[model samples]
Target: MVTTWFKKFMGKRLFDRYYKFEKMLPVFAIGDRFCVTHAEPKTHYSEKDIVNALVNREIIFNLTWTDNGQAEIGSVVRYLYDFFPDNQEARMFGGHRPIPISQNYLSRAGGKYIQIHNPSWYNIVYVRDMKDFLIYRDIFSILPLAERLAKKEEI
Candidate 1:
């Protein structure tokens, strides 16, 4: 089953990160492979703030519909833009698009992620999120993050 394969992948991928658990929990795969933190979300950030958040940042996104089971529950793409970047322009998976995530969402991205309202768009050339993606310090170490997660908790 794909479930077994995903667990294997996540285990190997997260091995160097977190402390081991007595019993391994089940990990879920949806949207894409990204980090999920415990930061707080901001439902009311000023327009100026968001604009500044995504300036000069190139994003990388492997989008799929929320229509499927993977679509709705797992919405935001949670990756460390600076998970291992050594330059100003971070390695993003997608361009900046307007995201309206709940504060719960922001916290998961460590308040470092931007929610994409309509993530179904294919080619996001010259978008807003590309500009202000500077949360370098917020980028978590995989090992530490893994230490925080023994198994996939859910979306």
Candidate 2:
């Protein structure tokens, strides 16, 4: 179907490289003081279950494709808290729904879950080490610098 056509268009070597890069992406990632995901899980899942789901296509789909509003933020925060009781300040970051640019970002469950999807938008979260982490769009922007780099690489 479309994938077959894309593979042909990209050539075998390019297609294989793209596929390998895609596979390297995680379904969900838990940092020392934060959790990042494409979207919220439909139900509470244990750390073990989440790790196992990384290899299960159906579970991966559920983790990445589920709608944002289905799960309550408080519940998700509570579930995460249970998993990492030591990190009381741990927060969850995810993006599936495109939040309004005017809104900037949406925080639910008392600012525990942050839903940010706008390509030009970003958020800074300060962690326990007094370090700040920037969470922005999942896709890289094709800005002038990126375009210049791409052209330079081509030459």
Candidate 3:
């Protein structure tokens, strides 16, 4: 019915390498798994400003494509150099390339993510999101206290 590619798209090898790279960082608690406040699309923050946002700092390293679904390597490249000519790292590592995202990954990655224009390229997960995946075992968490506080403050 299905092929191995679909099954392993985000599994095993990728997860192993990703986990090995990330395990070097200090561990965080479950409450630290999500952004305390919402993050704007990368389109909103400048290079310096995004770094200052305290949470979701990975957005600073990503390409922010505002145009809908024009996901091609050439198109992404043009947008990158035009928007961030001064950036040297983006020219070298294809790390920050932003492609059109599916609704599915958004539900998983939560705060911020980047898709590769090419399906073969791995979808870029934000550092915190990757942390949520490896640590919390789920990106979304149940925050009853925060929910109650919000409801009480609304009245």
Candidate 4:
């Protein structure tokens, strides 16, 4: 009963956030300097062009939302072209699942699940059907747990 109202109230607002990239605050390490990288060199864009593109791209899509949405080159994100070949983690990724959240997570989380933040690794998205996120919403979220259990050598 209460859950229905909550969803009704939020409605599109929940999905709207997915479009706002700049609003997504940058997560920084204690002493980490913001950096960006460009993994692939296929793009005709020069160093400066890539950096500007990254920021521009950041505004429309959620950079941290998906593996591809994120810049593969951490350097492009943190250092820009000033240190391109030197920095490589910022490989700019370009991919998207245009399906709505409901259809998108149908395989893993249906529409009700949300991927929670993880301390040690990437986000492990969950859906309402599994009931996993309900009991262990925070402490044992999928992020590191899934990776840790999946393989002893992956990480």
TM per candidate comes to 0.19, 0.67, 0.21, 0.25
Error of 1 at 25 (Å): 31
Instruction: Give the winner by TM-score.
Output: 2
86-126: candidate 1 lDDT, tens digit per residue: 33332323223323332111122323343323332221222
| Model 3 misplacement above 4 A | 1-65, 74-104, 107-138, 141-146, 153-155
Clashes in candidate 1: how many? 28
Query: What ranking of all candidate models by TM-score puts the best one first?
Result: 2, 4, 3, 1
Superior candidate under lDDT, 2 versus 3: 2
Q: Model 3 over residues 44-90: C-alpha lDDT tens digits?
A: 33435433444554542233323333233343333334454554323
Better of 3 and 4 by TM-score: 4
As for model 2, its CA RMSD to the true structure in angstroms is 4.9
Q: How many clashes would you count in candidate 3?
A: 0
Please estimate how well model 4 matches the true structure, expressed as its whole-model Cα lDDT.
Answer: 0.33
Q: Between which residue pairs do clashes occur in model 3?
A: none
Give the alpha carbon lDDT tens digit for every residue of 1-155 in model 2. Answer: 86799787878888888889988899888777777778766566777877888567776876777675777446667666876777666677777777776655677656777776655544333344313444344222334555677689652
Position 25, candidate 3: lDDT: 38
Which regions of candidate 2 deviate over 4 angstroms? 1-5, 8-13, 72-75, 122-155
Model 4 Cα lDDT, one tens digit per residue, 1-155: 65466457876576466436534543211112112121212223444554355456542233333442233433233333344434332222211333243221211112111222333434333233322333234223344556676787455
Weakest lDDT window of 10 consecutive positions for candidate 2: 130-139
- Model 3: lDDT equals 0.34
RMSD of each: 17.5, 4.9, 19.0, 14.6
Better of 3 and 4 by lDDT: 3
